[model samples]
Target: MSSTTPQASTTTDARRSFLSGFGKFTLSATAVALLAGRDRLALVGSAEAKTAGNDVTILNAALAAEQEAIAAYQVGATSGLLQKPVLDLAVQFQGHHKEHATALATTVKKLGGTPVAAKAKYTFPVEKLKTQADVLGFAAELERGAVSAYLGAIPILDDRELAKVAASILGDEAMHWAVLRQALGQPPVPSAFVS
Candidate 1:
């Protein structure tokens, strides 16, 4: 993406940070690739390779990002720039982000870690959202970033179930990105690969 949206790089960097957060027990990229819509999910012995403590930290970071996505959607939903149909889509997408956050937070608690709290405010390019198309373009950029983030997590996930979850989330975010791009009169899928 262009510099008009800095969140793209930030989101990718944020997701990549989870790689190092593995700490003492890093996952092997060759161990898994649980993309959604595939029935090839098989049990892996690498589940034991990850420590729950480090998972909590990594999950917290993802939780924080999800919370921010929720907030970003809220901003767009109430910006008065989106039409009725677009507002409806924004609200629906926000709900998905909330669901994502819930899942991450629940997992964090299950792992005996405190989930990150949402900030009272978030930073967004509000001034650039002068038109409905601008808002949609901004949202598309964000969804693209989310797709990258979740896609980055898949191969490095130690647990097969977690890898599946990551891939499923990646698929959802990818669809959101595609829909947003389509709404903006752009190609839904610019390339075969997301990155």
Candidate 2:
């Protein structure tokens, strides 16, 4: 009777060990299956997955913004409201924007994406360019918008190189905004930190 009792106990212990291992294996397989399903769903839900991420998308967006800035500066330069000095500055700023656009286009092409072309005309407040103040104000606002866009791009870019490029462009755009603000009789250094 004692031997029979030990045999029963050993059999119960072996059964428990096998069942415990099987339970763990089942849980692991289930977790893996769930994770795979989630990944598939994410892949099916967006074009981002099709592109293998947003690097090219981000670059193309930046390129488009640069094209818009170039067009805006062209309009401002031709408006005749700016004095000689201001017009020269606008031309210089426009050149800088062109350079940025070229760089962005090159990068986009290198990344296997198409660079966005400039539109024949952009929809700006052409009717409001009656005075120098209006022109300067519009230019300043456009610079501010460019600065904001580049600032926003810096952190969201996944590649460190692309982020650095964005930061460089951000600094230039911020400088342009500050100069425009100063020209508009506003303080050049409005705040210690640019938002």
Q: Pick the candidate with the highest TM-score.
A: 1
* Residues forming the 10-long window of minimal summed lDDT in candidate 1: 30-39
TM-score of 2: 0.72
Against the true structure, candidate 1 has what lDDT? Answer: 0.69
**All candidates' TM-scores?**
0.73, 0.72
Query: lDDT of all predictions, in order shown?
Result: 0.69, 0.68
Pairs of residues clashing in candidate 1: none
Tens-digit lDDT track of model 1 for 3-97: 23223323544335323332323222321232221122222234432455555676687788888887677667666788988898987887777
Model 2, 89-161: lDDT tens digits are 9878876777677667656655556777766555776776778888788888888888888877777776566
